[model samples]
Target: TTVLTPDVLIIGAGPSGAAAASLLRQYGYQVLVLERQHFPRFSIGESLLPQSMVFLEEAGLLDAVEQAAPEFGFQFKNGAAFLRGNERTHFDFTDKFTAGPGTTWQIKRAPFDHVLAKQAAAYGAEIRYGHTVTAVDVDGETPCADVVDEDGFAYQVRPRFMLDASGFGRVLPKLLDLESPSNFPIRRAVFTHIADHFDPAEFDRNKILISVHQQHPQAWFWNIPFADGRCSFGVVAETDFYAQFGDLALDDLLPAILASEPSLSKLLSRAEFDTPVREIVGYSANVNSLTGRHFALLGNAGEFLDPVFSSGVTIALKSASLCAPLLHRFLQGGSVDWQTEYEQPLRRGIKVFRAYVEAWYEGSFQDVVFAVEPQDEVKRMVCSLLAGYAWDESNPMNNNSVKRLATLAEICRDGRAARDALGQA
Candidate 1:
């Protein structure tokens, strides 16, 4: 029976919501963020790309993040390492073609998100936890939401502009019927945290390791290490591929799959899988429209391609950084084109990631990554994309990613075949 109005209403105090609130507040807007969950709640997507640091810095939250590094056990990360059978390759973010921060942290999402939300609140943004948006109406001039508190109190919030940053929750997408089937095929991931015990020299704790299944080209594992001797390990494969396992419990399932990847299995042999194994099926999603009226969707609320590249948080923060300024301009009575200024540009970066994700599953990118002799310039460009510089227009890979990646892949494969023929000769 209460009504509250804010200049901007952000749903979900996750990365995107927190970043947007901070950015808008910096621009002198009154921002209210509603989060259904409390701080320090468990969440996935533990990896962070270098590009995320730019947004955190711009939002004035990077200082807080760096300050929390020791307390939160934030792991130092400089690059990513990949493995398949006996071949191995790594991309040092510092060697990338892009001109930006070359290193970032491998984070625990729970603490990372809490830090961001807390910092945003410290910056004068009002953040209400345990408040869920049950209904949304954006058809009118002002976008509003019917929210219910934990104590059963119900209220309505009307804001001049609304942003949905509900990662995977997709609150507005579900409420307003903006959901669309993702173009990528259905996939699933089974994961858990482990008290990883490894010799410092044996494994590179500073880099996330992705190991491909020797037998199943479509299956892969992500080993994301944390500074506190803990690591996140997960396996992703097409949904039907898991059907063969047939209702096996996660505890039994994950270890069984890990046994198939020799390198990962040996590396994790002595590690403890302390947490309960978890599974997420069909996580890839999309939206029919990114914005309407006074509202727009940010991060996973709009579209989610895949987790293979760990692009979730980067995209979430990118969407926030891109939208805050445009929304600020509109609030200042300046004409803004949401389609061209926001959606199109955002989707362009997304498309670049999409092409890589698709190529990843199709095996083309793997060939490019593990090539016997990849060109330094080409590798640097690929490293830029991997570093989450997808929006950089100067990068040739950003334009026509699918075609360019395909051509590069073909060239790598041909060179590989020629080398094999010479070896036989």
Candidate 2:
């Protein structure tokens, strides 16, 4: 019977957990991170937002990421381009309203997650791969978990506090029955990697390309390019929308769907779909409580919005950034309010993103995005939100996203109508 004790216990060695460990270790805390999978595991979220760079730099892990960028084929990204039929526009992150890092990277999650875990280890955090947390017990004064190692050795870990950074695993939420129904409708994504034989002069490698389906604007494709000339391509839509292509394997179905989008079809006409296609269903999730007695859920464990904006990693890193300092203060015998100080602020940013996601699916946000002759100031404000500056209270978009977006949509429509009338006269 082996028992271990640490000042802080983190479940999952993904971005959030790894970042939390690094931050806590910087404060001289004995932090232990348990990860079920070994290094270089496959993950779906590859695109990153600029705001994530702030958290990585704060955790002192950005230098390692930069050093390993060349090895992992990380592609430089400064903005995102959107296309719907003949309408096309792009938002340069560097021109956003909020002030921060303007550029980020399109990463391969396998190596990206590994780099983060190793950096956390380098910062003196104890990370054990192939160790899975089977059960969690928080009824006692100290939080603890039952874990089984790869070799079948079982042990117990008791830590003064626990942070659940399990990402999609939702370890504590499931163990503690904290799950709740999400407000978002069920949606799914089918994706795979391709060897894109793109001409550098023809395609802009510095931005991610999002193409809307000509027939169904709600369904869209994300083309994320890597430095090695391969691209991560995926299509997203409501779960029922996929039912039309019955019994079609991802490999066969993806190509058929791609042909339906004229713009994307033409762009990737020379691409080779060499890898296996994959699918993820109903990934949107929510929980009843974010913090409960010596423990707090981080990232997807707390809540998850749509992936249309690529906010997953940013939210994960932001959670780690917000939780670490509060945990340190609590460990130092300070009265720390986990709800107001940690959970509320994190949810505020998430709420801002949620409003946009709702508008994206409902078509209001898309109207503004594709609006002809959009106001420059309005574009910058919306660009800030797109760049993952969801927490900036100074930005008007973050404060009243839904109302402002609706108003903007109406104005765009009216302007278009007036233009049509003038042309007829």
Candidate 3:
């Protein structure tokens, strides 16, 4: 066994862990990142929001990410058609945030995560791949962690502070006896990546493309483009939907469902399959406690919402930035009243997500607004909230608007009634 000491110990090397380590290093704190796998691994949720771009720039990795930027676009759905073609919402980074791009790039997450982890290393974080954390011992004065790497090598991380960013790995959840279940009837994800299925020369690549299925309110799909004309598409639906794939191969299994959704059917009419099918179950969680003892839960480790908004990475980075300074204080032989710094913000974020998810189910999503066209002022205000700006107090939907929307949604809980004139936006 090898024993190594660091100021901060981070378990799980996804965006949150990387962000924590990167920011800690910037503060001259010795940070150790323990990852179970190597870099450049494939991941889903390839689409992004404009606010997320600002975060990447803040982390100093934006310039590096542009080398692989896909075309910028947003495809909002109402009936079957996207309200705009080529023209979409590029608001934040365009006329308002900056004249830069106003759009977030569609990316292949494998290389993207790798770039972020590498940027952390460049910022002076000590990252050890294949270093899987096995167990943890916690105390406010001293915290101990045990990690096992491949080849049966064991190492100990004795850090003054710890941040668990092991999303859905449920590290802190298990310790705290927390339960995070699938909130919707939809429980699984079936997706695939195909080459030659997406080509800028052949298909519209200016905005993010989407397919809205009218039959099920829960059903929708994304078609994201990356380098080399590769395209990724998938569905997040009820777990039992797996029965459809029972007999036929994916290439053969895709058509029947495609035909059910007019929009998806039209887009894939000319495209061809290029890879094997893949699937994952959807999960939702809310921890009773986000901080305790000497450790803290960051990002999905604290809790996770659905993937519909593509918010995993942004929240990860932001949460890490929020908590890094607190950990830094602990590392400096100073006592940290972390709860004083994190409790309110954490509760606010959790309440906001709960309200948002409740409406997604309770309201039949009649008022659930997606960006279909250039939005009017109030519409954009709601869209910005959906786009993950809930933390900003000045934002319309942050305080009063969400309350108003919640009241409206409650009044129109049933499907037909939600669409009634009184419920009109």
Candidate 4:
């Protein structure tokens, strides 16, 4: 029966947890991170937004990531390509109105996450792997967590403050009963990695391909190419859509669904599965509050919108960067407002992404994206949002995304109608 104490205790070693540990350790605070899994474990969310670079740099992980990128064969990504039938549109992050890094990378989460966690360890944060936090008692002045190691050795950790970065594990949300209904419906994704023999001349390896099903607009596929000639492929659709396949092995289901998308089917026709097909269901989640006495939730521990925009890692890193400074101040015996300083601001950016995601699924934003002639300024604004500049107030698209998107969609509709009338004349 050993008791460990640290200035702060983090419940997971994912991006959010590691970022927080790295930042807090820079402020000379002792950080203890407990993780349920080992390093280099499999995870999703391969595509990254450019805005995440700032946070990584701030956490002193940029250099490590840069060195590991090439070693891991991560692909350099400057933009995203969207396709529907024969129409195609590309958004280059460098063309965005934002004033930050324009390019990011499409990485395997296993190595990317491991690199970030290792960087935190290099910064002197104590990260313990294979230690699962089973219970947390937050009623007292000092919160304590019950952790069990892989060999079933149990211990207690007492820290002045606690940060829950347990990701989809939702440690605090379930233990504290903070779960709330999400506005999004239950959706599912079937994903796998493939060794793709892509013709470099035919495919722009610098961008992720997002292809919409010609017949099933509600279903979409992601083809993220890696430098190692392997691609991460996945399809997202409503749960019922997958349920129709009912207990079919993922390997069998992948090809059947992929056949529906002609473009994706043709592109990956020469590809072979490099890993087992996997599935994730009901990933969209939310909680009533992000903070309580002595504890706050980060990353997926608090909320998750949808993966359509590839906003998960960006949001997670944003939460870590936002919460660390505030938590540092509070630990220094200063009064801190978690609601105003942390939760509200964090949710503001997430809300921006939420609006765009809603419009995307409803097919309104697609109209603007595929418009024959779109306004340059509007395109730049939308590109800024897509580049992860959701918090930039100078961009009107970030402030009123739904309204602005609707207006753009209407403009496209009118232009099409005018062309149709002229043809009739």
lDDT tens readout by residue for model 2, 1-425: 79899999999999999999999999999999999999999998889999999999999999999999999999999999898888788889999889999999999999999999999999999999999999999999898899999999999999999999898899998999999999888889999999988777657888988888888878989999999999999999998877777888889999999987887787788999999999999999999889988999988888999889999999999999999999999999998888899989999999999998898888877877787343456677788888999999998768777787777777766765322321232
C-alpha lDDT (0 to 100) for residue 124 of candidate 3: 91
Flag clash pairs in model 2.
none
How would you order the candidates by TM-score, starting with the best? 2, 1, 4, 3
Show model 3 residue runs off by greater than 4 Å. Answer: 67-101, 179-186, 196-204, 241-255, 333-335, 361-375, 400-403, 406-425
Model 2 residue 151 CA deviation in Å? 1.6
Per-model TM against the reference: 0.96, 0.96, 0.82, 0.96
**Model 4 whole-model lDDT (C-alpha atoms):** 0.88
Query: What local distance difference test score does each model get?
Result: 0.89, 0.89, 0.64, 0.88
RMSD of each: 3.2, 3.3, 5.1, 3.5
Reference-based TM-score, model 3: 0.82
2 versus 4: better TM-score goes to: 2
Q: Write the per-residue lDDT of candidate 3 for residues 134-229, one digit (tens) a residue.
A: 777774368888788898888788887788998878686776575556355656666787653543443565345545456665555666665455
What's the true lDDT of residue 282 in model 3? 62
Error of 1 at 241 (Å): 1.9
Residue-level lDDT tens digits of model 1 in 176-257: 8989999888889999998889778778998989889888989999999999999999999988877777788999889888
lDDT per residue for candidate 4 within 1-425, as digits (tens), equals 79999999999999999999999999999999999999999999999999999989998988899999999988999998888988888888898877999999999999999999999999999999999999999999799999999999999999999999999999999999999989988889999998988778767888988888888787889988999999899999988777666677889898889876788778778888768899998899999999988999999999999888788999999999999999999999998889889999999999999998898889877776777333466677778888888888888778767776666677766765322221232
**In model 3, what is the error at residue 71, expressed in angstroms?**
14
